[model samples]
Target: MATGDAKLILPFNSAFSSSYWMRWQTPVCFLITVSPGIAAALMLYRLKRRRGCDHLPAAATWAPCFRGVPPLVLPVYRGLVVISMISVLYCLLRLNGLVEFYFYTQWTFLLVIIYFLIGTIISAHGCWVYYRQRRRQGVEEGNRFLTFNRDDNVDNHTALVTADNNSGGKLEDKRAGTWGYCMQIIYQTCGGAVMLTDVVFWCILVPYMSSAHFSVNLVMGCMHSLNLLFLLVDTLLNSMPFPWFRMAYFILWSCTYVIFQWILHACGFSWWPYPFLELATPWAPLWYFCMALIHVPCYGAYWLIVKAKNTYFPRFFPHSYVSL
Candidate 1:
């Protein structure tokens, strides 16, 4: 087939048949479209509003990161922000014409970096404030410091926190101040952003959308792997607590992007950064719906990873810093 003819083919089309749906009108596609929505909804339903961080699970194995950023995790988390910021700047300055600038992969990469930057800044500020407050009060010698969710939760939709008596009454349920709250918002929002960004890039864009001559460069490679890597490392070190319902923020984030794209197209730009986003095709709605549904799983899987790390690590390595 001619190159021009190939370009005209719908993204879902292949060599054997023109339409992928026609070739495989089976249960798999139906499950893929419907399952994520149901699952995400169920997870949201499970979150009950609590008066305080009383419901916040207090596992001896895992520390609550939502309050104050751990002093140790700072370096790795900031390192990711640095790497991502540099990678993005390099791409924008050096490879401007070689890449699709507005593509979701690029957008997500940028978003993750922004998230890290905001989070790191807030954590640093909060930590400084914490120390200054300590010095001002003339208190010293205790390892446990009072922080938000130290014992109480302020959010109306916050889930229950599990108690760990083994903590020897060390964890306090203090209110998260301005900086702490900012960091919490950014941290929770990032839970889904990281997964959604990485999954789409690795599973869809790079494999199917990248052009024939497009080869993975150092930055390209780092951009994909490092986002997830940084978050996982943060998971191991930070005291931020991630709950399942926070995926709602992630959904809203993606929806905002789609709306922005629509607005841009409405103004005059005709190009869609991704072929899956093109509405001219008959299966466009299906594509959109499936993409929406997939968010739940992608987000859920990452949550599970955090939960798994929190659950198993203490049992396996009781003396690790992860064990509060």
Candidate 2:
């Protein structure tokens, strides 16, 4: 079956010359492709009645990554950095920073690691502030932490005094927010990038590429799947908001990659990392167009996972869910 799949993708010409994909791949791919449209349409069904998709206030800022997360959530964020760092070290050691024209997956995987590392630092600092403020305020009671405040305004929420300036203004407006805004952008974006890059690599690229004699190593599999696994686990554990409008960031991330690839090709790199990225193919335009469309569903899938957690977990275990 693997070899047959490879033969089906013989070349750019195969897209026109063959009907094999129509037999099996078509139905599956079609369903994957259309589901996003269906989801978006359904979401917009009430668009007319409502002002628009209501967004979390924290999600609107560049900070707070949707604030008031439980301290336990810190470990989940840290775990991503730990796992991704290991994966990255493994890749870097093996590849030794070799040639550049390999795959966009590697680039995106590295980006995710950096994203998590930065977020981990920011979240850690936030957790520290969260605790220190409580201690200072003398709110030693356990209930102080239980009150979930997702607001971005820190004036009343946190008692942590910002570094004062000679002019009597709080210097730079410091608090748990110092890292929250930027971390929020990267965290939301990395979620989609990690999922899109891995899902496509494992489901679509691997079977086809491996059949074409591309070596499928254990490390490669780990690199792809581990990212999604870590993020999914974090999502299930964390109370952070995952707003759908953040799909804008995901799309921009991919476009920036495409632009980078183009710049590399302009300099000297002759090969396209992913086959679909090669523009000489007759179906290249379609490939690019489909990829642009794919981002919507890829992001929405994660969005739904977060949404389900928010909607159902509270009903099943209200007390436990609050702690999440």
> If scored against the real structure, what TM-score would every candidate get?
0.66, 0.67
Tens-digit lDDT track of model 2 for 1-324 = 112212112222323324333344344434544454455555545553575343222222212322344564654556556775666556544453444224566666666676667656655655665566556544543334334443545422322233234543232322225355555556678788877887787788877775545655556666677778776766665546677766666666676667676556545555556777765545655687788788878888888888887788778865545422
lDDT of 1 by residue, 287-307 (tens): 877788788788888788878
Clashes of each: 20, 5
Candidate 1 residue spans exceeding 4 A from truth: 1-80, 97-101, 126-140, 146-172, 213-215, 321-324
Model 1 Cα shift for residue 81 (angstroms): 3.3
lDDT values for all models: 0.55, 0.56
The C-alpha local distance difference test score for the whole of candidate 1 amounts to 0.55
The weakest ten consecutive residues by lDDT in model 2 span 1-10
